[model samples]
Target: MTNENRFNFNDALLTALFGTPSRKNTIDRLGIVCPVFPDEELRKSAVILCERIKKMDDFSWTALCKMAK
Candidate 1:
């Protein structure tokens, strides 16, 4: 698939998983600034970040929770 097409698909998947793109949610989830992209790109980046977050260890989760609070 083309790069644009792949990006769109990834974006759609992220929106389906995370609702809308917002700094609040990203910060809450201990994500980076990449999710601040425009709607399409934001969604795609969010999905990628989500996958990475899922692989984080307990220490990472604890830090995220603390930061979120």
Candidate 2:
């Protein structure tokens, strides 16, 4: 939970620090690369969402990514 808001979005270290993103970030980047994600208006704060995503195990996180698409 360090203040990494300014950290480079393209840095290899982003995954290392924040852990793998849940179904959100990559899906956002997907727009036309894939379909819309499941929830577009859940409206959770980014800080809270990132913390929850980080707590997920690797397998669960991967599953979410696939299901998102």
Candidate 3:
């Protein structure tokens, strides 16, 4: 996919995986006004996130976001 498309996909995926956090909580915890994927660091972070998610027992959004970071 194109870079734009990939970024869009990643954003959607993260939103779905993490649900929609309360606006204030999200900003405080993640420092993101909206859901986003790591771009320049995608290669390294994606691999780690995927592996961590796969091993998670609960498969929760919070878990996924933690892993993604």
TM-score of each: 0.37, 0.36, 0.30
Clashes of 3: 0
**Tens digits of lDDT, candidate 2, 1-69:** 666443333222323333335445533433332233244332223334445455666676666545443
- Clashing pairs for predicted structure model 1, backbone only: 11-44
Tens-place lDDT digits, model 3, residues 19-67: 3333334323333322354465643434443444444455464554454
**Candidate 2 local Cα displacement, residue 48, angstroms:** 1.6
The global C-alpha lDDT for each of the candidates, from Candidate 1 onward, is: 0.50, 0.41, 0.42
When 1 and 2 are scored with lDDT, the better candidate is: 1
Q: Residue 7 CA error for candidate 1 (Å)?
A: 20
lDDT of 1 at 33: 41
- Can you list the residue pairs that collide in candidate 3? none
lDDT of 1 by residue, 1-69 (tens): 445223344444443444333434543553544457567756556656566555656565446444444
- Ordering by TM-score: 1, 2, 3
Query: Which candidate should be chosen as best, given TM-score against the real structure?
Result: 1
State which candidate, 1 or 3, has the greater TM-score: 1
Evaluated at residue 68, the lDDT of candidate 3 is 44
- lDDT at 18, model 2: 34
